[model samples]
Target: MSLAVNPRFIPPAASTFVFDPDLVAEGRRESVPRYGDPIWSVLALTQNPSAPDDCIRWHWFSGTFRETFRFAAWTLVNHPLADQELARHGIAMRAKLSAGRIMRTVHQWSIFAAWLDERGITRLADLDTEGLADFAFYLAKTRGLSRNTASGHLTGLSRLHYYGRSFLPPSDRLVEPPWVAEGMDDYLPAASPLGGENSTEPITPATMGPLLVWALRFVEDYAEDILAAHDERRRLLNAADAADGPLLPDSGDALEAFLEGLEAEGLPVPVAARRGNPLAGAGIYLAAVTGTPRSKVRQVMRKPHWRTYTAQNHGPCHLGTPVNATLDAEPWHEPFTFDGIDKMVRHLATACFIVLSYLTGMRSGEILGLASGCCPDPEGPPAEAGRHLIYGRVFKIATDEYGNHDSAGVVREAPWVAVPQVVTSVRVLERLGGDGLLFAAEVHDKRQPERRSGRSLQLSTLNERIERFIEWVNTHAENRERESEMIPQDTHGRIGAGRFRRTLAWHIARRPGGLVALAVQYGHMRTLVSEGYGSRSRGGIHDLLDFETARSVAEHLSEVHEAIQDGEGISGPAARRLIHSAAQEHHRFGGIITSVRQARSLLADPNLNVFENKDTFLFCNYDRAKALCHPGRSGKYEAPSLDRCKLNCANIARTDTHARQLREAADSLVRQASSGLAPEPLADRMQERAQGLSELADQHDRKRVLAGMEGHL
Candidate 1:
């Protein structure tokens, strides 16, 4: 009583026949009349499976018929089925339909097989041409398949279907479906093996071998020792936790990795400490000091506590305690060097500046503030050979109340005062005659005075020139092709003015080697970073003595007498009295005692070294050397009168020797750099310079010859 139909049905687009209701009814009627049977009832079930059993219905008993019916009319028209005879069988039902399901699955398979069918397609091969054609339509239109997909399906199905078809009889008569056209291939992107931004370019050994050797031998070996020491430090700290600070950059391996990482990130591996200072002792101390970043220790500490100037065999002196206050460079501008410079105007200024800066290290404003009268002849010839020989007893230069220059263009002048060092630098200028502007200030407006006005160059202008010189020297030294790589950017990637002072301090305090060695080391270090200047570690040590602690000690002494009975065996004041009394007979004890008392009381508590105490006492009437005229004035340390010195002062001899050595070292560095390059790399540049020199020589010869010829004529 129930009607069962195949569960699967294809969309109408896959049908071979474009069925019209009217044509189907007429066909059915004709078929029933000829057969003289109730074919309509059975045929009705084929037309409608849902039809009432009492009336007519359509039902597709065959999966092939159902699948073929799903395709669009257009697809059916193009792929006409060879199994058209199956429709005349009143649609196969039940037992016959079960066979049709196999036929349908085969039909789907045949469409794929048709691609490889060649001309020998057949029915016993399991599907006829019509079934294959119908299945092709079913796949394309019913399944919404694009030609590529259809082609791919066909290729895959052909492997299995064609192999099966090979066993069939050739008389089966299967016709292939028409070929489906395809478009260009789809673009399939390749998967990247290593994702993100990474370099594909390999690091070749030719370029990397030398770098490797430097790291392994120089850096790694040194670093291993540093690590061993660090381990020792940790053990010590664990024993006495209060002594050491937190570990820095952790271990040697960590430090190494940090350096490599920075280099990889395009930064130079900063040296932990420079050479001359032998960072071992100080570096270990600094590495253990807490409360600040390592880079900043120099600024706070003032580096070397005592400067050991051996020229005169007095001990060391505290750095901040000025040896000669009048000789301070603050009043003058920074000096410029002209040794290798050849530019006309720049060289002229540089020459003047070198004389001034080497002698004074002045601020530019102070140097330019000098008047003609500032360089009056010394009462006698200089006792020394330097810029210090020039007299600077005129008005001391200073910015007006506004300080420096203001937007209003008013530059107020201050009173003149003697700058002891200025006297020496001015001698070089005085040789040119003090007639013109010493350092002509560049400005525009009606306020301008005559050309020789006592005007000085603006500080900014002088700084610009200094920067230019630095650039030129660095460029020549580096042979750099790009400017950006010459100086490093800060952490935030910025450049600034602090570079010069820092570089100078580093050279004086840290870096390794003698002058030549330092220069060579600098060259190599800079080359590694592509910067033009010498690479030096800017590490420092703080002065050991503290003014506050000294003051506390002095203050504590005053109250100690109150804590003990007057008859106490050894009172603090009694000890002081004993020392002072003993000093009366012993010269060394005298100076030391006096200095200690002064440091304990009225005088500013100084970080006194032996030379400093000696100098202090010599200045204050003790005159242990019997050299000073008055207590601590010019007369105390001044040169002898010109008539007395006769240009033969021993001080002048020492000064000249030092100056000559310094200049020679600088020149040697230049020469060493000239020889550093390989012959091949420099051949062309050398030839070009030679050729230019030869042409000039030839021109000069021609001129001389012409002059002789004219005279003969």
Candidate 2:
């Protein structure tokens, strides 16, 4: 028999059967449920301080992979192996793998298990080597998996078999390198062609120039309007609580009259509304805008206070709050989503997220993990000059022996050297999350997949909103009659994440005036990282990697541009003409690639193709470098390098992404100087940088102008 504990709201409505407890080990009661409960949710909420762990029916069910799915769903495979310690393995793996990874792996294995049971292979001891070989063949042919993908499955199986190898009989155990027989490679699916690297595109003027401009302005000017409205709403709700009695619930007449007497006699109110400014939730907004993992977003939301609230089928329902939520946004039967003050609060959060993410290259997860008091410590050691720091838990990198988070879902120990824009965002979120967590309440609840209740916002949602934020910028620009500020998408449609980071890095590495906004933000994370986030932290390392990748791309493009000036042969009619015209003018540009951004401007022309020479790792589309081409080459083979490029090489081209970054840098410097915040020396430097950038922009513009005048001129 089980005892049920119901959670009652402060207003004394019907109780919710939230935590169901089971008596185990001594008289001390634990909320451990039997076979049917979501054990993970119970385990998770069990950690909650305020939760009634001893005697309550936990509302959510979030057990391990096996508990939540195959086993819980009542698909009992009555086999000896199924009853063994593999369930423990699932939880152990969850420590290393993300929740998303855990789900996918569990699903895959569950399918394999069901297939095994159907084949009368209930126990591992009963299966032989022939069965293993047959299963591998079946997995490839039946699942239609590519060679690499099938290999991954086989790897997973190998690990599991290795785990149970000690307990199983020697004959029953699957051997290492499953097929020792030589020349049996033909039985498995062939591996797919190894695809080359996928470079993340940088945001460019030709790509999302206008969109970025509008987004920046929105962050600067319009975001406050929403925040102001939300604050005012909170103030009004507090005032209402002060004016009115706790509730008009149908209590006895004597109780009602006694309560009415307080209002009639002008006495103080009984209960107050929830406290804390909603602007503190800006971290949630940042996570949504920037692209944080769904897990971190929920952590931020849950802190400080639970965001999800539910109305228990009571109240007269005529509270004059915002029209966004006049009643319970969700019925008692439905899982909760934010309503009332939350609607206004979340609106501001959304705005903050969209604006902050575009301005700062902080990862979505990093932004979400941010706490209230985590940046630019004024009283830090003076030796830490030249670097701005952000203190927060980084979840992905520093795994323990069990591959689990260090504490309460936090994998902390380092400070990220942040930009001022990121610092400002942190400050804003500090106000929202206070000295506690950054995100809380109304987070997506994963325990009950059936309902959208207490959960963290999934990664998919954050990315989707990122796409939505882009569309919003375009729509808002059109609405404001600022068509020139319109941000456009690539042919693939939608702005990409990888290129955005690369673009920022390119500007920083190039040190161009147009991209100077991020200049003050750059620092060697290693300088401060040693004290906190040891070398193991992946967040700091990843940021550095982005910077390096952009630098490499810039150097390659510059080398190719220099080659063209050295009278390298050109491909295509337009490219040949461009070379001939450029030969007349003694112009040489590169080194600080952002100063010129030649690739961006030249890319506007229609008759150019940027193709990568996989052999040389250089972009060459002259199509004349037949020897460098992978196939269809008629000429003799000759080695090519950036130092010694022949005029016959056809594989020379560039991307406009870097050029646009340079343009932005110059614009930023101009803006900074105009604000009069920069020092005199810096101001002078800004003007000089701006002038050089304008000359480069003009050079590119001249080509465009002359192109427009083609034939007619």
Candidate 3:
């Protein structure tokens, strides 16, 4: 029971006393860790018996350590003392530290060991406060690590001193914790001013808009053709598998008849895209068409009649079922041939990923973690008409009922609210035919069955796939001469999985039309939409929303300040107050808000009542007493209901830009009235509306005040 026994007493290969003996007793004997084991598979020691082996396994430092550094450093990490200390630390704080955290600790220990070996300090007892200080300096100055990252390295070393007392002998244990006197902060570089800013850039609207449009085209329009080709390929493979015996007596005749049928219908013989030799292409395609094995088809192709037929039709053929989806009133793509079916299916899956990730605002991992039935069709009438939900496990910040870090992750109690598009994407993924994860690694390739670990597609691989999807879409658009519809290259670089949720939050927070689109198109209530996204503790979509909202407000204020400086005029009850406050804040902040806190403080100023209402033709310089948008609502903070703006509201503000937009609206109404398609009464109403909008614009031009006239106003 005592783990404090001298290390010299036990052989190197002996089992370590790190695991809970009671749990080890119940587990298979082979799963136990030995001191000399090069890689320790330790999931058996944890309560999560079903966790993946890679998640729990600890590989002792070997390959790169041995190749790059001295053998002594490699031995230092592989040493029995190092093993005991880390094992003790892992077991003692298993509740707080996850399997991934334990792995990170081991990595930090290896780095520390390498630093010790370089300095020829063979034993921990030889290390003192001065040596620890040198190591801290090495990490910051030599390694060029950021303050936070250096602190992480120092934290691991400090834990060694804390945990080593119980596991290491007195001579091997450190005399004191690392940075005990001055704290780790003193030894590290000063934190950067932009250190805590969220570095993940949201995808710009130009890029995301076209990307989602094409993804919808794939999911809603072209899915049937891709999936049909997928089904046909699967059926052919199944038939080939079942026909293991020798070829049928009439197999050659059947293939001949099929070729004749193709000729009679004036359809070209189906051939693989890149296959050069006619006989080879014929063998492959005829086998698929005739439900015969490729080997059997090759044998039959040796006949003189078939050789003549293939010679006449040597080029690649597009002879599959044509899909009904169209682009610009024409077919979007050619018929789905067998040669490119696999590629189309992979693209279809990627399209589903894009739709699901962009629309639902689910993290990449959560989307990939989805199973076949995660978003099944609702059963009851009430549920059928209700919101669709996707049920999946969340790994980040996931915990078991006992409040322990669960490496296996926990099923999310509140599922992600899915729009109709997301629901369709899930259904398409289900039809693609993968078990367990919807985006399983083996879904695209089944040749390497040995490598099938039932894990979801990796983030790096998915990123590459996204790039390919973009290239394919651009190519397709170019071929159709629709250059205007191509997805623009994002200035932020490649569109990775992490960008989707951030971009969704940015759109929801900054774009009022975006909110209405989500409500009308996606059937989402604003409250439930935010709640669904913010339910995951680690998602931070709500924080992103807050930051984006604040940033938008700051930008709005900056624009107003610039407009006023340019001698623009404004008219409204609150216009004079708005101009004065904007001028004051601009002077106070130098018109540059650098941080979220500064932005939030700017938004809190009651005198700066400039609220953006871009969808409408005016800004709301809101005063609750004169507000007509929300009459009876009272709270610590309130927002103007821009959707219900009244024409005569006192809070309405109009600058030159708003007046121009009003004139444009009037022109549009006049054009609609003269279109000749409307009834006489409706046309008259439209003309009246146009006249009213024109009068409003004329009134704004008459009463608008120039800058520096606030005192007279």
Candidate 4:
């Protein structure tokens, strides 16, 4: 019923059945597949700029099309587009075809579109290979395009030219780009200027500033709501005028005022203190000054004595205020642990630094500059007496590798802050060692040039001795039960040096009753003194115990004994009450109580350590006024000798009374057994008294005889 008219001549590559104009038009409505999809490649090139005049098929293929399209759009919106310009024509064509999605990654395409808009060339048929080459030169020499990137644009253009002409007959003079001209192969290099792998662009610091600014702006405007609410920020801006000077200063009076204002207004500190550097520094400084996690500051305010919260995480003393419901309301991830550090490849100094860090929570740079004579033993043998002291400072040092060897390395004296455990641990490392770099220092080897610059431990001739130490610890822990407890189990592989310091902080914050007893003790004492106890004391208690000193003594006790004894008949709560009452009466007590019940309560309530007196009695242990006893009096407590013990043993239990009592008991038992006067009230019948009890009396006699056989047998 239909009559067929001769169709227009279709290329051989075209399907046998002529494509219906309606169908082709409808097909264009379908989404162009993503550039990454193979189907996008099948679409006919739609706009080649290098085609000769009157070449219809050549007009279809487009080179540098997508990138140019976006460029054209951007240029049109930002820069005026002129009629008859080649860039304008290209841009207009792109707007009709791709809409906009193709422009995302295609940066170079816009340059060409701008070129066309400026040149007044409306059609691809109007341009020739020479014209395209002129544009390429414009992009490179004039537009400041890198030579390699310009070459990439050239490659895409050439591909379009080749494919565009394929749609035309041989006689059609659709001139090709210079690079693709036949019999001129020698003129074209094997690869485009940007084709090689070496042409890849690298990000430099110079370029990063703009990106960083843009990203920061984007984050501020969109992702993070830090700058969203203006009322709170206005308050901070008003306060910022007051907070000038050093980045972080000891007295945060102005900062405290700002924070207090925010708290008074019932806003979160993080939310209220979010204005500028001083505010940021407030969060960080509070962490260092108070020794709590940056994440826990909110919880500190709710305590009954808010001012005393500084001692909560720093040690176990109660802060005056109740830690607010807000802080307790939030859940935080469990802090990092250091169970697998022995597997890390680190320098001995670095490892020692790691240990020092875990034991002391010192900053990395601070730990590095520790002096050799820091921990001197006051009472040991003259040659071995660096063991008497357990205190030091950490400083900053600079090292140079150049001709100025005279001033190559310099050390500075830092503020001296004493931590009993740190002092003891450092002394242990020193007494057992020799050192080059106290912490790992990056070194340059004068050996093979390529391998010349690397880091090494000077103490060991080759390799990091820390690795060996960690491996030994790991292996020993795996084989021994006692060591296993100290080592953290790592389902994930390897350990980092930073984790040690963090873990130390975590345990102090989380395990105040067990591992952090000493830290808790000292932190409490320091807080009390620093808070001006004399001024605040109700009874004019001038002989207040120095929190730091008391803490140090407690720390020494904890190091000597890992755990408080169980089955002590005293409940954790009861123990806390007893200790708190004692501390109140003595006015010189500072120690942590490590009872299981108290520890559980501490963990369950984050506010426990965030406020004063929350854990006052809970973490207290040692008696600064009397001799230190092992928890539970499990065994006879031994007096630590000045030459051997590193603890503050000034007030140890006197052994005279206990020794006399034990000697008398032994004599009484010996006499009763030896004289056959031991009473057996259970039975009236008497078997001949066994000599076993009599033999025990003889053994006791022999031991007594041996004990008195001193100096001259």
Q: How well does candidate 4 match the true structure in TM-score terms?
A: 0.23
lDDT score, candidate 1, position 566 = 28
Per residue, candidate 2 scores C-alpha lDDT tens digits across 1-713 of 43322122111111321223331222223333344443322322222111111211223222222322323111111112232334633322321333333334444555555566668665544666667777778878987877756665565554445433433334334444354333236546975533211234455536545544444444444344434444554554454334333322332233334334544665432221235433333332223232443334344345442232111111111223223221124211112212233433443344455444444445555555555576656565778655566666555454556554332335445555554545555555555544554542233122323222222334445555557666666675577666765666765455543344444444433332123332232223222223333354255433433333334434544554555645343332234333333332213323232222243333322223232333122244334344343344545322222333332354443223223444777898899998988898999999898777666445444333232233331
Per-residue CA lDDT of model 1 for 1-713, tens digit only, reads 11112123222321212323343344343222111121112232122211111211113213332222222211221222223322432222211121112224334444443443434432334565455455555566666666644554443333222222222223322333232122112211222232211111212223222222222221222222322333444443343344334445532333334334544565432212225442212322332333333333333233232112111122111111111211123311112111111132342343345334322323233345544455554464577533212222211221235232111121222212213323433443443334544554322111332321224544444555544544443363255333332332223221112222222222222221112111123222222221211222111100101122223233322322222122222211122332222222222222222222343332231211111011111001122233222224343332111111211111111111222333444445445446756375465565554454344334323322111122231
What order do candidates take by TM-score, descending? 3, 2, 4, 1
TM-score of each: 0.21, 0.49, 0.78, 0.23
Worst 10 residues of 1 by lDDT: 610-619
- Which candidate comes out best when scored by lDDT? 3
Clash count per candidate: 45, 60, 0, 63
**lDDT (CA) for every model shown?**
0.29, 0.41, 0.67, 0.33
Instruction: Name the lDDT of candidate 2.
Output: 0.41
Please give the ranking of all candidate structures by lDDT, highest first, separated by commas: 3, 2, 4, 1
User: Which ten residues in a row are the worst by lDDT in model 3?
Assistant: 67-76
lDDT of 4 by residue, 1-713 (tens): 11122232122221222122232234332322222221222121211111011111211224433332322222222222232332422321221112112222133444555576678764455677778767766766676655445555665454334323433223322246675443223223243333221122222223222322222222222111221222233333344433333443334444455446655765444311224421223443343333444444434444455444332222211112221212124311121112111112122223345445544444443454444566554675778743232233322122234211111123322223334444544543343233422332322122322211122222232223434444554464355543422333333333443333333333333333332332324333232222322343221111212221223333433321222221111122123333233323223222342232333333233212111111211123323233232333333332111212212222222112222333454555555555656565411122222233233334333432111122222
lDDT-better candidate, 2 vs 4: 2
Tell me how candidate 4 scores on lDDT: 0.33
